[model samples]
Target: MSRALGIYIHVPFCKQKCVYCDFYSLPRREDQMDAYAAALRSQLFETDFSGCEADTVYFGGGTPSYLGPRRLAALLEAVFAACPIAPGAEITLEANPDSAGDPDALSALRRAGFNRVSLGMQSADDGELKSIGRVHTMAQVRSAVEAARKAGFDNLSLDLIYGLPGQDLPRWRKNLSA
Candidate 1:
């Protein structure tokens, strides 16, 4: 039996760097987006993906949605042209609720073949989100989830983190229970 292959695409663009985050991400440069997309396409074309089929394609980083629709579509086109993603494959994109919660953004993602979205919910408590330099509120996360659902995405994932300031055991338990 042949093993399934997965594509991991890193989008190193963030609105602002988080103190807790140590990932490789930089600020978004609108002027460089096209060049970066071209570079990615060139690299994908150069890769030797002959027999192995891609069962999953994940776009992770500071925030994938920061690229907006057009650039992301171009990248997706390159992925489709260079590698064969199996039918019904999981195409995931990591996004922050602040930017990706809107209906238009979610719809654009769905149209571009993103079947799943990993939203960085961080915590259910708004204070925790604020303390972590996250601009979006928990309400925004809920709204984003609803928007994603409305956008026809059935496979939705939320990223939650523990050990924030002022978080007691009971508070954590309450957070989990909510």
Candidate 2:
């Protein structure tokens, strides 16, 4: 029997760099996105998946949602065409609070064969979020969660970061409780 594999596609584009992060991420330049998409497509096309099937497809890092809806759809389309994904494959996209907040964008993702969404919550407290240079508010996270639900996403996931300059154990507990 052949073993099934999982796929992780890294999208190295960010709206802005986080102060603590040193990951290699290119700023989203309008002129460069199309080329990025093309390179991604070319790479996907050139890869051989003859004996293995993909059981899960994860679009991760700098921020997959930074590509927005249509571009993201195109990426998904390419992946689906190039790889043999299982019938019930877990397709996940990592998105920041501000980017995944749009209902239409979520809808587009759903249509593009994504079944899961991992949101970058950062922190529940607005102050904690700001201390890390996150532009979105907790309110935006709430809205994004709501929007994800409305867009028919049941397997929603949230990611949080802890241990900041002013983050105490008590505050961490409070953040989790909220």
Q: Best candidate per TM-score, number?
A: 2
Off by over 4 Å in 2: none
Show pairs that collide, candidate 2: none
Alpha-carbon lDDT of model 2: 0.87
Report every candidate's CA lDDT.
0.85, 0.87
Model 1 gets an lDDT of: 0.85
The residue pairs found clashing in candidate 1 are none
User: Compared with the true structure, what per-residue lDDT tens digits does model 1 show for residues 1-178?
Assistant: 3457999988888788777888987874667767777899899999988887899999998788888878887798899999988998899989898877778878887898889999988888888888898878888888888888989889999887878888888878766775
Candidate 2 per-residue C-alpha lDDT over 1-178 given as tens digits, one digit per residue, 9 for 90 to 100: 5569999998888787777677777765656777998899899999998878899999987888988888889988988899888889999999988888888879888988999999988889888788787878989999999999999999999888878788899988877876
How high is the lDDT of residue 93 in model 2?
93
Can you give the lDDT of residue 135 in candidate 1? 70
Worst 10 residues of 1 by lDDT: 27-36
TM-score of each: 0.92, 0.95
